[model samples]
Target chain A: MDNNSKLTNLHMDAIREVGNIGTGNAATALSRLLGRTVDMDVPVAEFVPIYDVAAHYGSPETYVCAVLVRTEEEFSCSLIFMIEEEKAAILADLIIPMDISGMDEETRLQIRDSALSEQGNIILGAFLNALSQITGWVLPTTTPAVARDMLGSIMDLVASMFGVIGESAMLVKTSLHIKGLDDELGGTVIMIPDPGSLEALLSKLGVL
Target chain B: MTQPIHVGMADLVVSKHPATLVTLGLGSCIGLVIYDQASKTAGMVHIMLPDSREAKNLPKPGKFADTAVPLLLEELAKLGVNKSQLRAKMAGGAQMFSMPGKADSAIFGVGSRNVEATTKLLAASGIRLVASDTGGSKGRSVEFSTETMKFIVKTLGTGTKEL
Candidate 1:
C-alpha cells in the first residue's frame, strides 16, 4: 500500500478530473433516460482498502445492487456501480420496464435486479465511452452483470485482482445528486485500477 | 451476554467457552476456524492470500494462508489447547466475480488457492479439516461458537448453513 500512497493531492486532482469528465457523460445519459436533470459531485480519487470499501456506504453485509464491470484491454481496471438495496429498488421502480408495485416481494426483487443491470450498462458504458475519448485508448467496456448480494460477497469475488496487485485500491468515488427529486437517490461509481494501469494513467495525465 | 469477537481482514482472534468468534466478509479471503473440544476454545483467522512468498512487503501472517495457519495454531497452543486435539473447520475463499473472457480460468484463482494452501498447511500441522464449504462465486460471513464448535457460513441471499 506504500506504493499506493504516492499519489499526492495534485495527482489525485488530476485523476479526479478524468473521473469528472467520464461520470459527467454518465450523468447526462442518466438524465436523458430518467427525463430529469441529474448532477454529479467532483470525484475524489484515493487509495482504499478492499475490505472496508463497502463500509463507506454502510455495513459489509448491507444488501446492495451492484454492477461489476472490468476491462483488461488498454490497461486493466474494475469499476463498480453500487446502490443500497432500497435506493436501488427506488431507481428500479422508475427505470424497470415492468410494473413492480403490484408484484409480490420476490417478483419485485427480480424486476429490480434486471432493471439495475441494464442501468449499469447504460451509465457505466457512457463513462467508458467518454474515458476512451480522453485517454485516446479504445477501452472496450466489459459486460456488465448485476448481483443483488452483500457488498462483501461481491468484493470477495473480485479481491484477487487487488490481492495480486496491491492491497489498496485506486478508488475513484463519484456521487450522483438528484436534489429535491431524491436527495439520496444517486449512486457511486468506484473504479479500482491495477497498479500498472494507475501508473500509466497518472503518467499520461502528467501527474507522475 | 457474551459478544462475538470480530476478526477483520488479515487478522485473527481466539475465544473461550460461551464466546463467539466471527469474521465479516470472506470474499476471496478465508476464515480458518480451529477448535478444541476439551478446552471449549475456538480461534479464527481471516486470511487474504495463499502464500507469504507472494507478498513483497513486511509479512503479516494473517494476510496469507501459508503463514496464518501455523501462527494461529501456535496462538491456540499457548492458550493451553494441545495442537493434537485441534480440529479445523474453514470457510470463505469464494470468488465473488469473474473476468470477461477469463471466466474459465479466473485470474490468480485466489479462492481455491487459499483453500489449497490452508489444507496443505493444516495437514502438515496434523490437524484434520472436519468440515468446510468453500470455492464458489459468493462471499461468505462466518461465525464459530466455542460451545458447540460449530462453524456457521452466511451468504448474501442464501441465508445461513452450518459447516
Candidate 2:
C-alpha cells in the first residue's frame, strides 16, 4: 500500500481509539444520570462520504433525538448523541419518573423532551471530556443544540458545516444500551472531525 | 406516473411541472431554484461554496455559486426558458454552530456566505429573487414544484412551510 494509504489507516485507527475512550466515559455518565448501568458495543470510526453518514446508523428518515455539540479548535470537530424518539420518550420517563395521565400536552412534552435534551448534553459532554484528557487538546464545544428530527436533516447540517474543510467526514461512532433495559431502547453516538484536523490528529497519533 | 428528480449534495437538475425537484438536508449550503413560469421550465442547483476560485477551478460547476448559477441558467436556456421570464427562490443557509466571542470569524460563516453569494449571482444573472427561506440555526429539506412555483421548506421544530 502507498504511504498515504497506510497513514490514513493509522488515522482511522486513532479515531477508533478515541471512540472507545469517549464512549466509555459517556456510558459511565449515562449510568450515573439514569441511576442504571450503561454499556456499549465496540466503537467504530472511519472516514465516510458526506452522504453516507445517515445510513451508517439506520434509515435516513429515522426520527431521532439528538444533542449536537460543535467543537472549536485548530482541529475542530462535532459530536452528536442520538436515540430514537420513542426510546428517548422512554428515557424521559426514567429521568422524570412521573405519570403523564393528568398532565396537559404542553407540560407533558416539556418534561419528557427536556429530559432527553439534558441527556444528550450529559452524554456528549462526557465524551468530550474523555477526548480532551487523552489528546491533551483543549477542545471547546458549542452549546448543545437539541433536536427531535429526521436523521437525514441533522446529518446534512453536519456535512455542510464540516464541508468547509472537505467533502468526506471522519466519524468516530459507538452504540449504547442501558443495562437491564431492552437493547432496542439504546442509540448511537457519532463524532465528525474537521478535515483540517486530520493531519494534526494523525501526526499526534504518530505512526501507531 | 411521475417521480421527483432528486438532487444530492453538490449536484443540480432541471425539470418541468407535475414533476417535482427536491434536495434533502441543506445546512450551510444553498439550494438555488429558478424557473421561467411562462415556459414552465425549472432548475435547481445544490451549491456548497460561494466562489469557484475556492474550489481551485475544478470542473464541478454545480458545487459553487459563481459557477453553478451561470451553468444552471445555460441549461435552462437550452430547455427554452426565456432569460427575462426566470425568477428565483432559495433555501438552506443555516449556520449550524455558534462561535464563542468571535461572531465575525469566517470559520463558521459558510451559511451566511452561501446565502450572500446566491443572492448576488441571481441578481447579476438578471433573475429576480422572489422568495427565500434562509439563515438561522436549523437545517431544511427543500422541494420546488414547477407547477405552482412553490418552494416548500421542511424543518424539524417549525413544521413545513411554503414560500
Candidate 3:
C-alpha cells in the first residue's frame, strides 16, 4: 500500500471519530436549551481543499455567528453556526417570544440583542464544551461576534484570524435538528493542521 | 412629476425624471447604476450574486451581477440614454466575513468576491465608478439622488455619508 493512501485513510478515521463525539455533545446541549427531545444526526466529515469547500456546500446565502475557545492545552477550536437569515430570526423568536403586533423599536432592539448575543452565548458555549470533552481538551471561552445578512463579510473576518487553510485541510459538516423548533441548523468546523500535527495526532490515536 | 425608484435585492428599476434610486439592507450584495446626466435618465440594479453561471436557466437574469449590469445598460440605451455619457456609482459590499475558528474558510469570504465581480463587470461595460463605499462589517442603505447626481450611503451603527 502507498504511504499517501495510508495517510488518507488515517485522517478520515480521525475526522469521523471526532465528528461523532462532537455531534453527540451538540445534541445534548440543544435538547436542554429547547426543553425537548432533540434528535441530531451523526456529522458527515470530509477533508477537502479550502478553495473547493464553497462549491461543495451549494452556496446558499448564509448567516453566521462564530467564536473561538482555547483549551488549557494551548489548542483552539472555532465554533460557528450557519443559518439562513429568516431561519435565524425564527430561532431568535423561539428563544425569546416577542409581541409582534405593535411592538415598539426598543422592544425590537431587545429581541435583536437577545437573539444575537444571548443565543450566541448559549449555542456556542455548549458546542465548544461538548467539543472539548469529546477531544479531552479544556477550551477557554471567548466573546463571540454576531453577524447578520452577509456570509462573505463574516467569512473574511474568520479567514484573517485562522489564515487560509491549505488544500489538504478537512471541513467537518454537522446538522442539528431541535425538536419543537421545526428547523435545522447546520454547522461546519474546519480542521486546519500545520506540518505534522495531523499525522502526529493520528499516530498517537493508533489510527495511522 | 418624478418619484424615486428604489431597487431592492434581485430587482431593477428606472426613471427618466431625476428619480431617486434607493437600496436598503445591503450586506455583501451590490447596488449598481447607469445614469445619463444629459437625458436625465437613470437605472439601478440590486444584484445579490456575482455571476449568472450558477443561475443557469433561472427566471430572473437580473439577479446576478454579470447579467444584470448589461441588461440595465441595454434597457437604458433603448430609452435613448447614451452609453458615452453614462456615469456609475456603487455601494454595499461589506466584509460580512465570520471570525476565524467559527466559519468554513471556503464560503465565508464572498463579500470581497462580490465587490471584485461588480467592479469588473462595470468596468467592462465602460462605466467608470465615480464613487464607491464598500468592504466593511456593517450593512448599508444606498440612495442615488438624481437631483444632484449625488450618492448617499447610510450605514448601520454609523452615520450617513454623501459622495
Best by DockQ: 1
* Candidate 3 or 2, higher TM-score: 2
Docking class of 2: acceptable
Identify the leading candidate in terms of TM-score: 1
Per model, state how many residue pairs clash: 4, 0, 17
The superposed Cα distance between candidate 1 and the true structure at residue A88, in angstroms, equals: 1.7
Cα lDDT tens digits for candidate 2, A1-208: 1113445555667778889999999999999998887889998876666556566666655777787776776557778888888888888888886688589878987787678768888898899898888878887767776766667656766665445445556678889988777645787898876656656766676754
Assess the local accuracy of residue A36 in candidate 3 as a C-alpha lDDT between 0 and 100.
69
lDDT (tens digit, per residue) of candidate 3 on B89-136: 888667563455634333444566677888998888889788888877
For A27-66, candidate 1 gives per-residue lDDT tens digits of: 8988888888888988988766755655655778877778
Cα misplacement distance, residue B107 of candidate 3 (Å) = 15
Q: What's model 3's TM-score?
A: 0.53
User: How accurate locally is residue B92 in candidate 1, as Cα lDDT from 0 to 100?
Assistant: 78
Candidate 3 per-residue lDDT over residues A1-208, each given as its tens digit:
1123455655776766766676666667766766767666666655543222333543323444433232223344455665556566566666675555477867765566456556656665676576566555566765655666434434333322222222233445676665654566444433333323455446545677
Which sections of candidate 2 miss by over 4 Å? A1-6, A55-60, A73-75, A97-113, B16-18, B56-59, B95-108
lDDT sort, best first:
1, 2, 3
Model 2 TM? 0.86
lDDT of each: 0.78, 0.77, 0.60
Candidate 3 chain B least-lDDT 10 residues: B102-111
Off by over 4 Å in 3: A1-7, A60-73, A97-101, A105-110, A157-165, A181-208, B1-130, B139-163
Error in Å for residue A133 of model 2: 3.1
